[model samples]
Target: MEIIGYARVSTREQNLDLQLDALKEAGCKLIFEEKVSGVKDRPELDKALSYLREGDTFVIWKLDRLGRSLKDLVYIVDCLQKRKIAFKSIVDGIDTNSALGRCQFGIFASLAEYEREIIVERTRAGLQAAKERGKLTGRPIGLSEDAKRKAIAAKRLYENRDYSIDEICRILHIGSKATLYRYLRYEKVRLMNRRNK
Candidate 1:
């Protein structure tokens, strides 16, 4: 049976060298490495899971490296068990093929779910308190007040026919003509509606 290893780090700046070396020393025939946050989707991890087969072993350097939530980790282990594939976490000393390991996994999973629920509850309470205080929880993304002003300036410059679209982009530090056009389209709609009124 082949041994497949997976390793992950939360950020792109983080290194996977240590986990790679450990997995290699552990006799991993193939290893998948991903540089992304646990909350983000991992294409490499999906590929590794897809490559698994009966009698093959799945390995990881740590439990958290395998998945963000304990529930997700447990689900992965359960799938492996159903497939007759073994699972191991080198750092955590967890092996799903053993009785003791299975018991420990259940306990760990339950505690993790409990902790997650507590965090969710506290976050909701905090958001409610902030709302009561008339504070926004977070700022909106994309074009803001400053961007709208710049977009309006770009439209005015464009209508003057003195500068090309490219020149307008350069002047405003806009990324592309396409993005500027999107903003222009919105403004065009707003202008049309005002005239219709």
Candidate 2:
């Protein structure tokens, strides 16, 4: 049986040396390496999974390294078994060629599913609580006070007829039409207050 190893890291900054070394010691004939976020596209992983044939063994350093999500791990293992490919994890000491390994996987898969359900429940509860408190959770507004000030100054310059809008924007280093519109809104608010007074 051909032994193929797969090693993955979540970012370009992480080293694959340790996993690669372990796979090599485990006698893998070929090792596939990928530096990608596990939550997203995993083309290399998909290819490795597809390449498995009957009697072929897929090896990895650890189960967690294969995937962070339990569902994904279970799916991959299930596919390998369906194709009659053996699966092994060096650190977890799991070998699909044995009866005990199958039992262990069943238990681990159940626990993983339970953990995911709990995570979903907790996240929904937290979001509901935050909604009750009128708290917004997402990307914060990017404009800082200094940036807003520069936009306001640019608007004021144009309003006072001190400088053309283009010239003021050039001086303030704001190049986008959307940003100019924001400034215009700020100016309109001030203009309305002045008129009221």
The best candidate by TM-score is 2
Candidate 1 Cα misplacement greater than 4 A, ranges? 112-197
Clashing pairs in 2: none
Give every collision pair in model 1. none
Query: What global local distance difference test value does model 2 have?
Result: 0.82
Clash number for model 2? Answer: 0
Q: Model 1, range 151-190, lDDT digits (tens) per residue?
A: 7887787666677777878889989977777777756733
User: Candidate 2: minimum summed lDDT over ten consecutive residues — where?
Assistant: 188-197
Error of 1 at 32 (Å): 0.9
lDDT of 2 by residue, 1-197 (tens): 89999999987888999999999999998988878655678888888887878999999999988876788889889889889999999999999999999898888789878988999999999999998999987766556787778767866676676565566667788887457657667556353223211
